[model samples]
Target: MKKTVTILLFLLINSLVFSQSLVDLSKREKERRARLKGKTIIIQKGGDPARKGATLKTDPSGLAEETEGLDDLTSLDRESPPQKRMIPKTENPPEETGADQKDATDLQKLEEQLRKAKEYVELLTLKMNALWQEFYSMDDMKSRDEIQRQISETYLNLQKAQANEQKLQKDVEAR
Candidate 1:
Protein backbone atom coordinates (compact mmCIF):
# COMPACT_ATOMS: atom_id res chain seq x y z
CA MET A 1 0.00 0.00 0.00
CA LYS A 2 2.82 2.38 0.83
CA LYS A 3 4.56 1.65 -2.48
CA THR A 4 1.32 2.25 -4.39
CA VAL A 5 0.80 5.58 -2.60
CA THR A 6 4.37 6.64 -3.36
CA ILE A 7 3.95 5.82 -7.06
CA LEU A 8 0.65 7.73 -7.20
CA LEU A 9 2.26 10.77 -5.53
CA PHE A 10 5.10 10.74 -8.02
CA LEU A 11 2.73 10.52 -10.94
CA LEU A 12 0.66 13.42 -9.58
CA ILE A 13 3.73 15.67 -9.19
CA ASN A 14 4.99 14.77 -12.66
CA SER A 15 1.61 15.51 -14.23
CA LEU A 16 1.45 18.88 -12.47
CA VAL A 17 4.87 19.93 -13.85
CA PHE A 18 4.05 18.71 -17.38
CA SER A 19 0.63 20.38 -17.33
CA GLN A 20 2.22 23.69 -16.38
CA SER A 21 4.66 23.41 -19.29
CA LEU A 22 1.83 22.60 -21.68
CA VAL A 23 -0.07 25.66 -20.47
CA ASP A 24 2.99 27.87 -21.08
CA LEU A 25 3.54 26.40 -24.56
CA SER A 26 -0.10 26.97 -25.49
CA LYS A 27 0.09 30.56 -24.24
CA ARG A 28 3.17 31.21 -26.40
CA GLU A 29 1.52 29.62 -29.45
CA LYS A 30 -1.55 31.82 -28.97
CA GLU A 31 0.63 34.90 -28.76
CA ARG A 32 2.54 33.95 -31.95
CA ARG A 33 -0.70 33.25 -33.83
CA ALA A 34 -2.13 36.60 -32.75
CA ARG A 35 0.94 38.41 -33.98
CA LEU A 36 0.81 36.70 -37.41
CA LYS A 37 -2.96 36.62 -37.87
CA GLY A 38 -3.41 39.63 -40.17
CA LYS A 39 -0.13 39.17 -42.04
CA THR A 40 -0.23 37.49 -45.47
CA ILE A 41 1.64 34.22 -45.91
CA ILE A 42 3.55 33.20 -49.02
CA ILE A 43 3.87 29.50 -49.75
CA GLN A 44 6.88 28.40 -51.74
CA LYS A 45 6.38 26.24 -54.83
CA GLY A 46 7.80 23.01 -53.41
CA GLY A 47 7.42 23.92 -49.72
CA ASP A 48 4.65 22.71 -47.46
CA PRO A 49 2.35 25.46 -46.22
CA ALA A 50 1.85 23.55 -42.96
CA ARG A 51 5.55 23.82 -42.07
CA LYS A 52 6.52 25.99 -39.11
CA GLY A 53 8.63 29.00 -40.23
CA ALA A 54 8.53 32.66 -41.15
CA THR A 55 6.10 33.41 -43.99
CA LEU A 56 6.67 36.32 -46.37
CA LYS A 57 3.60 38.44 -46.97
CA THR A 58 2.92 41.28 -49.38
CA ASP A 59 1.66 44.53 -47.92
CA PRO A 60 -1.79 45.34 -49.42
CA SER A 61 -2.31 48.63 -47.57
CA GLY A 62 -0.88 52.15 -47.82
CA LEU A 63 2.47 50.70 -46.65
CA ALA A 64 2.86 49.15 -50.11
CA GLU A 65 2.21 52.55 -51.74
CA GLU A 66 4.85 54.14 -49.46
CA THR A 67 7.45 51.65 -50.76
CA GLU A 68 6.64 52.84 -54.32
CA GLY A 69 8.66 55.97 -53.49
CA LEU A 70 11.75 53.79 -53.08
CA ASP A 71 10.99 52.19 -56.47
CA ASP A 72 10.80 55.69 -58.03
CA LEU A 73 14.23 56.55 -56.50
CA THR A 74 15.71 53.43 -58.10
CA SER A 75 14.12 54.32 -61.42
CA LEU A 76 15.58 57.83 -61.22
CA ASP A 77 19.04 56.31 -60.66
CA ARG A 78 18.66 54.29 -63.84
CA GLU A 79 17.53 57.40 -65.78
CA SER A 80 20.47 59.57 -64.62
CA PRO A 81 23.61 59.90 -66.76
CA PRO A 82 26.73 58.00 -65.76
CA GLN A 83 29.23 59.93 -63.63
CA LYS A 84 32.66 60.82 -65.13
CA ARG A 85 35.86 59.42 -63.64
CA MET A 86 37.64 61.73 -61.19
CA ILE A 87 41.22 60.76 -62.28
CA PRO A 88 42.39 62.02 -65.67
CA LYS A 89 43.86 59.52 -68.14
CA THR A 90 47.64 59.80 -68.54
CA GLU A 91 50.48 57.77 -70.09
CA ASN A 92 51.77 56.90 -66.60
CA PRO A 93 49.18 56.72 -63.83
CA PRO A 94 50.37 57.68 -60.34
CA GLU A 95 50.95 54.63 -58.13
CA GLU A 96 50.85 54.39 -54.33
CA THR A 97 54.37 54.03 -52.83
CA GLY A 98 55.10 51.32 -50.21
CA ALA A 99 55.42 53.92 -47.44
CA ASP A 100 52.07 55.48 -48.39
CA GLN A 101 50.36 52.09 -48.32
CA LYS A 102 51.98 51.29 -44.95
CA ASP A 103 50.86 54.63 -43.52
CA ALA A 104 47.29 54.05 -44.70
CA THR A 105 47.26 50.53 -43.21
CA ASP A 106 48.66 51.80 -39.90
CA LEU A 107 46.03 54.57 -39.78
CA GLN A 108 43.23 52.06 -40.32
CA LYS A 109 44.66 49.77 -37.61
CA LEU A 110 44.92 52.67 -35.17
CA GLU A 111 41.35 53.76 -35.89
CA GLU A 112 40.07 50.21 -35.36
CA GLN A 113 42.07 49.82 -32.11
CA LEU A 114 40.75 53.14 -30.82
CA ARG A 115 37.16 52.12 -31.62
CA LYS A 116 37.64 48.79 -29.76
CA ALA A 117 39.15 50.57 -26.76
CA LYS A 118 36.23 53.01 -26.59
CA GLU A 119 33.76 50.13 -26.77
CA TYR A 120 35.64 48.34 -23.99
CA VAL A 121 35.44 51.42 -21.78
CA GLU A 122 31.73 51.77 -22.40
CA LEU A 123 31.13 48.07 -21.57
CA LEU A 124 33.24 48.34 -18.41
CA THR A 125 31.31 51.43 -17.29
CA LEU A 126 28.01 49.57 -17.73
CA LYS A 127 29.34 46.58 -15.74
CA MET A 128 30.56 48.83 -12.96
CA ASN A 129 27.18 50.54 -12.66
CA ALA A 130 25.34 47.19 -12.59
CA LEU A 131 27.74 45.87 -9.90
CA TRP A 132 27.23 49.03 -7.86
CA GLN A 133 23.49 48.53 -7.96
CA GLU A 134 23.87 44.87 -6.97
CA PHE A 135 26.21 45.79 -4.12
CA TYR A 136 23.74 48.31 -2.73
CA SER A 137 20.87 45.83 -2.74
CA MET A 138 22.85 42.99 -1.15
CA ASP A 139 22.28 42.07 2.49
CA ASP A 140 25.53 40.15 3.10
CA MET A 141 28.77 41.95 3.91
CA LYS A 142 31.06 39.46 2.13
CA SER A 143 29.03 39.60 -1.13
CA ARG A 144 28.93 43.37 -1.03
CA ASP A 145 32.72 43.53 -0.52
CA GLU A 146 33.30 41.22 -3.50
CA ILE A 147 30.95 43.26 -5.69
CA GLN A 148 32.68 46.48 -4.59
CA ARG A 149 36.09 45.07 -5.55
CA GLN A 150 34.71 44.10 -8.98
CA ILE A 151 33.34 47.62 -9.44
CA SER A 152 36.73 49.13 -8.56
CA GLU A 153 38.58 46.82 -10.98
CA THR A 154 36.09 47.54 -13.76
CA TYR A 155 36.40 51.30 -13.18
CA LEU A 156 40.21 51.12 -13.31
CA ASN A 157 40.07 49.15 -16.56
CA LEU A 158 37.61 51.66 -18.01
CA GLN A 159 39.98 54.54 -17.15
CA LYS A 160 42.93 52.73 -18.74
CA ALA A 161 40.96 51.97 -21.91
CA GLN A 162 39.76 55.59 -22.14
CA ALA A 163 43.37 56.84 -21.79
CA ASN A 164 44.57 54.48 -24.54
CA GLU A 165 41.70 55.58 -26.79
CA GLN A 166 42.65 59.25 -26.27
CA LYS A 167 46.30 58.55 -27.14
CA LEU A 168 45.27 56.71 -30.34
CA GLN A 169 42.95 59.58 -31.28
CA LYS A 170 45.83 62.05 -30.88
CA ASP A 171 48.08 59.85 -33.03
CA VAL A 172 45.39 59.70 -35.74
CA GLU A 173 44.93 63.47 -35.64
CA ALA A 174 48.71 64.07 -35.84
CA ARG A 175 48.89 62.02 -39.01
Candidate 2:
Protein backbone atom coordinates (compact mmCIF):
# COMPACT_ATOMS: atom_id res chain seq x y z
CA MET A 1 0.00 0.00 0.00
CA LYS A 2 2.90 2.42 0.78
CA LYS A 3 4.62 1.66 -2.56
CA THR A 4 1.39 2.31 -4.44
CA VAL A 5 0.95 5.72 -2.77
CA THR A 6 4.55 6.72 -3.58
CA ILE A 7 4.12 5.72 -7.27
CA LEU A 8 0.91 7.72 -7.50
CA LEU A 9 2.64 10.85 -6.05
CA PHE A 10 5.49 10.52 -8.61
CA LEU A 11 3.06 10.18 -11.51
CA LEU A 12 1.11 13.27 -10.42
CA ILE A 13 4.28 15.40 -10.22
CA ASN A 14 5.48 14.14 -13.62
CA SER A 15 2.11 14.95 -15.22
CA LEU A 16 2.19 18.50 -13.86
CA VAL A 17 5.70 19.13 -15.29
CA PHE A 18 4.79 17.70 -18.69
CA SER A 19 1.59 19.76 -18.83
CA GLN A 20 3.55 22.99 -18.27
CA SER A 21 6.25 22.15 -20.89
CA LEU A 22 3.92 20.88 -23.66
CA VAL A 23 2.79 24.33 -24.88
CA ASP A 24 6.34 25.66 -25.34
CA LEU A 25 7.52 22.47 -27.07
CA SER A 26 4.61 22.49 -29.54
CA LYS A 27 5.19 26.19 -30.41
CA ARG A 28 8.92 25.58 -31.07
CA GLU A 29 8.23 22.57 -33.31
CA LYS A 30 5.65 24.54 -35.32
CA GLU A 31 8.12 27.37 -35.92
CA ARG A 32 10.88 24.95 -36.94
CA ARG A 33 8.62 23.22 -39.50
CA ALA A 34 7.55 26.62 -40.89
CA ARG A 35 11.21 27.66 -41.43
CA LEU A 36 11.90 24.33 -43.18
CA LYS A 37 8.90 24.83 -45.48
CA GLY A 38 10.08 28.35 -46.37
CA LYS A 39 13.56 27.03 -47.23
CA THR A 40 12.11 24.28 -49.45
CA ILE A 41 9.91 26.79 -51.26
CA ILE A 42 12.86 29.19 -51.79
CA ILE A 43 15.01 26.40 -53.26
CA GLN A 44 12.20 25.36 -55.61
CA LYS A 45 11.84 28.96 -56.89
CA GLY A 46 15.59 29.57 -57.48
CA GLY A 47 16.46 33.13 -56.38
CA ASP A 48 14.09 35.17 -54.22
CA PRO A 49 11.31 37.07 -56.03
CA ALA A 50 11.73 40.76 -56.92
CA ARG A 51 8.47 41.67 -55.15
CA LYS A 52 7.32 40.32 -51.79
CA GLY A 53 3.85 39.39 -53.15
CA ALA A 54 5.22 37.62 -56.24
CA THR A 55 4.42 33.90 -56.47
CA LEU A 56 6.62 30.96 -57.47
CA LYS A 57 3.93 29.71 -59.88
CA THR A 58 5.90 30.98 -62.90
CA ASP A 59 8.67 28.83 -64.49
CA PRO A 60 11.74 28.88 -62.27
CA SER A 61 14.02 27.05 -64.74
CA GLY A 62 15.07 30.32 -66.47
CA LEU A 63 18.16 30.60 -64.22
CA ALA A 64 19.75 27.56 -65.87
CA GLU A 65 19.00 28.97 -69.37
CA GLU A 66 20.52 32.35 -68.43
CA THR A 67 23.70 30.66 -67.20
CA GLU A 68 24.07 28.78 -70.51
CA GLY A 69 23.89 32.07 -72.48
CA LEU A 70 26.43 33.69 -70.13
CA ASP A 71 28.83 30.76 -70.67
CA ASP A 72 28.67 31.22 -74.48
CA LEU A 73 29.37 35.00 -74.19
CA THR A 74 32.36 34.35 -71.93
CA SER A 75 33.78 31.85 -74.45
CA LEU A 76 33.40 34.34 -77.29
CA ASP A 77 35.21 37.01 -75.28
CA ARG A 78 38.08 34.57 -74.57
CA GLU A 79 38.49 33.77 -78.30
CA SER A 80 38.94 37.47 -79.24
CA PRO A 81 42.43 39.00 -79.04
CA PRO A 82 43.08 42.29 -77.15
CA GLN A 83 44.56 45.37 -78.98
CA LYS A 84 47.98 46.97 -78.31
CA ARG A 85 48.73 50.73 -78.13
CA MET A 86 51.81 53.02 -78.46
CA ILE A 87 52.15 56.03 -76.09
CA PRO A 88 54.57 58.98 -75.89
CA LYS A 89 55.83 61.06 -72.95
CA THR A 90 56.14 64.86 -73.19
CA GLU A 91 58.08 67.62 -71.39
CA ASN A 92 56.18 70.53 -69.83
CA PRO A 93 56.87 74.00 -68.39
CA PRO A 94 58.64 74.92 -65.11
CA GLU A 95 55.22 75.04 -63.39
CA GLU A 96 55.33 71.25 -63.56
CA THR A 97 57.81 71.40 -60.66
CA GLY A 98 56.15 71.18 -57.23
CA ALA A 99 55.72 74.27 -55.05
CA ASP A 100 58.45 75.16 -52.50
CA GLN A 101 58.09 73.57 -49.07
CA LYS A 102 58.78 76.95 -47.40
CA ASP A 103 55.86 78.43 -49.32
CA ALA A 104 53.65 75.58 -48.14
CA THR A 105 54.62 76.27 -44.52
CA ASP A 106 53.86 79.96 -44.93
CA LEU A 107 50.49 79.16 -46.52
CA GLN A 108 49.54 76.89 -43.63
CA LYS A 109 50.53 79.55 -41.09
CA LEU A 110 48.44 82.13 -42.94
CA GLU A 111 45.49 79.78 -43.05
CA GLU A 112 45.68 79.26 -39.27
CA GLN A 113 45.81 83.04 -38.72
CA LEU A 114 42.84 83.53 -41.02
CA ARG A 115 40.84 80.86 -39.22
CA LYS A 116 41.56 82.51 -35.86
CA ALA A 117 40.54 85.89 -37.16
CA LYS A 118 37.33 84.52 -38.62
CA GLU A 119 36.46 82.87 -35.30
CA TYR A 120 37.05 86.11 -33.40
CA VAL A 121 34.96 87.99 -35.95
CA GLU A 122 32.15 85.46 -35.56
CA LEU A 123 32.23 85.84 -31.78
CA LEU A 124 32.11 89.60 -32.12
CA THR A 125 29.19 89.30 -34.53
CA LEU A 126 27.33 87.14 -32.04
CA LYS A 127 28.02 89.66 -29.26
CA MET A 128 26.71 92.44 -31.48
CA ASN A 129 23.59 90.41 -32.23
CA ALA A 130 22.94 89.77 -28.54
CA LEU A 131 23.45 93.45 -27.69
CA TRP A 132 21.03 94.53 -30.41
CA GLN A 133 18.51 91.96 -29.27
CA GLU A 134 18.73 93.20 -25.70
CA PHE A 135 18.51 96.83 -26.72
CA TYR A 136 15.40 96.21 -28.75
CA SER A 137 13.75 93.98 -26.16
CA MET A 138 14.33 96.15 -23.06
CA ASP A 139 13.04 99.71 -22.56
CA ASP A 140 14.65 103.14 -21.80
CA MET A 141 17.50 102.89 -19.22
CA LYS A 142 17.03 99.27 -18.19
CA SER A 143 19.36 97.69 -20.81
CA ARG A 144 21.41 100.78 -21.74
CA ASP A 145 24.67 100.16 -19.83
CA GLU A 146 25.01 96.48 -20.77
CA ILE A 147 24.20 97.21 -24.42
CA GLN A 148 26.80 99.99 -24.62
CA ARG A 149 29.50 97.80 -23.08
CA GLN A 150 28.74 94.95 -25.50
CA ILE A 151 28.85 97.27 -28.54
CA SER A 152 32.25 98.65 -27.46
CA GLU A 153 33.64 95.14 -26.99
CA THR A 154 32.29 94.07 -30.39
CA TYR A 155 33.90 97.09 -32.12
CA LEU A 156 37.26 96.29 -30.56
CA ASN A 157 36.97 92.63 -31.68
CA LEU A 158 36.10 93.69 -35.26
CA GLN A 159 39.17 95.95 -35.39
CA LYS A 160 41.40 93.13 -34.15
CA ALA A 161 39.97 90.73 -36.77
CA GLN A 162 40.52 93.28 -39.54
CA ALA A 163 44.19 93.67 -38.57
CA ASN A 164 44.68 89.92 -38.48
CA GLU A 165 43.04 89.52 -41.89
CA GLN A 166 45.33 92.14 -43.41
CA LYS A 167 48.38 90.34 -41.99
CA LEU A 168 47.17 87.01 -43.44
CA GLN A 169 46.61 88.57 -46.89
CA LYS A 170 50.13 90.01 -46.86
CA ASP A 171 51.58 86.65 -45.90
CA VAL A 172 49.65 84.87 -48.68
CA GLU A 173 50.72 87.44 -51.29
CA ALA A 174 54.35 87.26 -50.19
CA ARG A 175 54.22 83.50 -50.55
Candidate 3:
Protein backbone atom coordinates (compact mmCIF):
# COMPACT_ATOMS: atom_id res chain seq x y z
CA MET A 1 0.00 0.00 0.00
CA LYS A 2 2.85 2.41 0.84
CA LYS A 3 4.57 1.69 -2.54
CA THR A 4 1.35 2.42 -4.46
CA VAL A 5 0.76 5.75 -2.61
CA THR A 6 4.35 6.90 -3.26
CA ILE A 7 4.03 6.07 -6.99
CA LEU A 8 0.76 7.98 -7.19
CA LEU A 9 2.31 11.05 -5.56
CA PHE A 10 5.28 10.91 -7.93
CA LEU A 11 2.96 10.75 -10.95
CA LEU A 12 0.94 13.76 -9.71
CA ILE A 13 4.09 15.85 -9.25
CA ASN A 14 5.43 14.83 -12.68
CA SER A 15 2.15 15.70 -14.33
CA LEU A 16 2.09 19.19 -12.72
CA VAL A 17 5.68 19.84 -13.90
CA PHE A 18 4.93 18.67 -17.46
CA SER A 19 1.78 20.83 -17.59
CA GLN A 20 3.82 23.96 -16.64
CA SER A 21 6.52 23.07 -19.18
CA LEU A 22 4.02 23.07 -22.08
CA VAL A 23 3.17 26.83 -21.54
CA ASP A 24 6.04 28.17 -23.74
CA LEU A 25 6.15 31.09 -26.27
CA SER A 26 5.14 28.73 -29.09
CA LYS A 27 1.94 27.77 -27.29
CA ARG A 28 1.16 31.46 -26.57
CA GLU A 29 1.67 32.32 -30.30
CA LYS A 30 -0.53 29.41 -31.34
CA GLU A 31 -3.34 30.57 -29.01
CA ARG A 32 -3.01 34.19 -30.25
CA ARG A 33 -3.15 33.14 -33.91
CA ALA A 34 -6.14 30.92 -33.21
CA ARG A 35 -7.99 33.92 -31.71
CA LEU A 36 -7.08 36.05 -34.79
CA LYS A 37 -7.92 33.32 -37.38
CA GLY A 38 -10.82 35.08 -39.17
CA LYS A 39 -9.11 38.56 -39.22
CA THR A 40 -7.57 39.62 -42.56
CA ILE A 41 -4.31 41.59 -42.78
CA ILE A 42 -4.68 44.52 -45.28
CA ILE A 43 -0.99 45.35 -45.83
CA GLN A 44 -0.54 48.02 -48.49
CA LYS A 45 2.76 49.07 -50.11
CA GLY A 46 3.29 52.05 -47.74
CA GLY A 47 1.69 50.20 -44.82
CA ASP A 48 -2.03 51.17 -44.19
CA PRO A 49 -2.36 53.98 -46.81
CA ALA A 50 -5.83 54.89 -45.44
CA ARG A 51 -4.47 56.37 -42.19
CA LYS A 52 -1.76 58.31 -44.06
CA GLY A 53 -4.32 59.62 -46.60
CA ALA A 54 -6.72 60.62 -43.78
CA THR A 55 -4.03 62.74 -42.07
CA LEU A 56 -3.01 64.36 -45.39
CA LYS A 57 -6.63 65.08 -46.28
CA THR A 58 -7.19 66.94 -42.96
CA ASP A 59 -5.02 69.89 -44.22
CA PRO A 60 -3.92 70.12 -47.91
CA SER A 61 -1.19 72.74 -47.19
CA GLY A 62 1.10 71.92 -44.24
CA LEU A 63 0.98 74.14 -41.04
CA ALA A 64 3.01 77.07 -42.54
CA GLU A 65 0.54 78.52 -45.14
CA GLU A 66 -2.62 77.38 -43.26
CA THR A 67 -2.70 80.84 -41.59
CA GLU A 68 -2.14 82.64 -44.94
CA GLY A 69 -5.56 84.43 -45.17
CA LEU A 70 -6.36 84.27 -41.42
CA ASP A 71 -5.76 87.95 -40.44
CA ASP A 72 -5.46 90.99 -42.82
CA LEU A 73 -3.66 89.14 -45.62
CA THR A 74 -3.55 92.20 -47.96
CA SER A 75 -0.15 94.02 -47.84
CA LEU A 76 -1.62 97.61 -47.99
CA ASP A 77 0.55 98.90 -45.06
CA ARG A 78 -1.72 101.89 -44.10
CA GLU A 79 -0.84 104.12 -41.13
CA SER A 80 -2.20 102.67 -37.82
CA PRO A 81 -4.69 104.67 -35.66
CA PRO A 82 -3.35 106.88 -32.81
CA GLN A 83 -3.26 105.21 -29.34
CA LYS A 84 -6.33 106.26 -27.22
CA ARG A 85 -5.78 107.97 -23.87
CA MET A 86 -7.57 105.84 -21.20
CA ILE A 87 -8.69 107.96 -18.22
CA PRO A 88 -9.31 106.00 -14.98
CA LYS A 89 -13.01 106.03 -13.99
CA THR A 90 -13.99 108.09 -10.93
CA GLU A 91 -15.24 106.20 -7.81
CA ASN A 92 -16.81 107.47 -4.56
CA PRO A 93 -14.62 107.12 -1.46
CA PRO A 94 -15.81 105.01 1.48
CA GLU A 95 -17.65 106.80 4.29
CA GLU A 96 -16.55 106.36 7.93
CA THR A 97 -19.34 107.42 10.32
CA GLY A 98 -18.79 107.09 14.12
CA ALA A 99 -16.60 104.00 13.83
CA ASP A 100 -14.49 105.12 16.77
CA GLN A 101 -17.44 105.08 19.18
CA LYS A 102 -18.57 101.65 18.04
CA ASP A 103 -15.03 100.29 18.29
CA ALA A 104 -14.57 101.67 21.82
CA THR A 105 -17.85 100.15 22.97
CA ASP A 106 -16.96 96.74 21.53
CA LEU A 107 -13.49 96.93 23.09
CA GLN A 108 -14.95 97.64 26.55
CA LYS A 109 -17.34 94.69 26.25
CA LEU A 110 -14.55 92.36 25.16
CA GLU A 111 -12.25 93.54 27.96
CA GLU A 112 -14.95 92.99 30.60
CA GLN A 113 -15.71 89.52 29.30
CA LEU A 114 -12.00 88.59 29.16
CA ARG A 115 -11.43 89.81 32.74
CA LYS A 116 -14.40 87.81 34.07
CA ALA A 117 -13.28 84.66 32.24
CA LYS A 118 -9.73 85.06 33.59
CA GLU A 119 -11.00 85.40 37.15
CA TYR A 120 -13.15 82.29 36.78
CA VAL A 121 -10.19 80.32 35.42
CA GLU A 122 -7.98 81.51 38.27
CA LEU A 123 -10.59 80.49 40.81
CA LEU A 124 -10.89 77.08 39.17
CA THR A 125 -7.11 76.58 39.25
CA LEU A 126 -6.93 77.55 42.92
CA LYS A 127 -9.70 75.07 43.72
CA MET A 128 -7.87 72.35 41.83
CA ASN A 129 -4.65 73.06 43.74
CA ALA A 130 -6.53 72.97 47.07
CA LEU A 131 -8.11 69.62 46.10
CA TRP A 132 -4.71 68.22 45.10
CA GLN A 133 -3.21 69.29 48.43
CA GLU A 134 -6.10 67.76 50.36
CA PHE A 135 -5.73 64.49 48.46
CA TYR A 136 -1.99 64.35 49.19
CA SER A 137 -2.36 65.46 52.85
CA MET A 138 -1.49 63.17 55.77
CA ASP A 139 -5.19 62.62 56.58
CA ASP A 140 -6.65 61.21 53.31
CA MET A 141 -10.26 60.80 54.43
CA LYS A 142 -10.68 64.48 55.36
CA SER A 143 -12.30 67.15 53.11
CA ARG A 144 -14.11 64.85 50.66
CA ASP A 145 -16.97 67.36 50.26
CA GLU A 146 -14.53 70.19 49.53
CA ILE A 147 -12.81 68.15 46.83
CA GLN A 148 -16.10 67.31 45.10
CA ARG A 149 -17.19 70.94 45.30
CA GLN A 150 -13.93 72.04 43.72
CA ILE A 151 -14.37 69.51 40.84
CA SER A 152 -17.93 70.74 40.24
CA GLU A 153 -16.80 74.35 40.31
CA THR A 154 -14.00 73.58 37.82
CA TYR A 155 -16.47 71.88 35.43
CA LEU A 156 -18.84 74.88 35.64
CA ASN A 157 -16.02 77.35 35.02
CA LEU A 158 -14.83 75.32 31.98
CA GLN A 159 -18.33 75.43 30.53
CA LYS A 160 -18.49 79.17 31.11
CA ALA A 161 -15.11 79.64 29.43
CA GLN A 162 -16.32 77.69 26.40
CA ALA A 163 -19.40 79.87 26.22
CA ASN A 164 -17.24 82.99 26.47
CA GLU A 165 -14.96 81.65 23.71
CA GLN A 166 -17.97 81.10 21.45
CA LYS A 167 -19.20 84.63 22.18
CA LEU A 168 -15.79 86.05 21.31
CA GLN A 169 -15.82 84.13 18.02
CA LYS A 170 -19.23 85.52 17.21
CA ASP A 171 -18.05 89.03 18.02
CA VAL A 172 -15.07 88.67 15.68
CA GLU A 173 -17.24 87.28 12.92
CA ALA A 174 -19.70 90.15 13.34
CA ARG A 175 -16.86 92.58 12.79
Name the candidate that leads on lDDT: 1
Question: Candidate 1: where are CA atoms >4 Å away?
Answer: 1-94
* Decreasing lDDT order of the candidates: 1, 2, 3
Q: What tens digits encode model 3's per-residue C-alpha lDDT throughout 1-175?
A: 9999999999999998888878775799678656545532211122322321111111222221121122321111111122233546559735556887678668766755655455445434544565566656636444666556656666666667657767775675676
User: What does candidate 1 score on TM?
Assistant: 0.46
How far in Å is the alpha carbon of 141 misplaced in model 2? Answer: 1.3
Error of 1 at 155 (Å): 1.5
- Expressed as tens digits, the lDDT of each residue in 122-166 for candidate 2 is 545555676777778877785687677657766776687778778
Higher-lDDT candidate of 1 and 2: 1
Which parts of model 3 are misplaced by more than 4 Å? Answer: 1-96, 138-142, 169-174
TM-score, one value per model: 0.46, 0.39, 0.35
Backbone-clash count (model 2):
0
lDDT agreement of model 2 with the native: 0.52
For model 1 the local lDDT of residue 35 reads 59
lDDT of each: 0.60, 0.52, 0.50
Which candidate, 2 or 3, has the higher TM-score? 2
Please rank every candidate by TM-score, starting with the best.
Answer: 1, 2, 3
Residue 123 CA error for candidate 3 (Å)?
Answer: 3.1
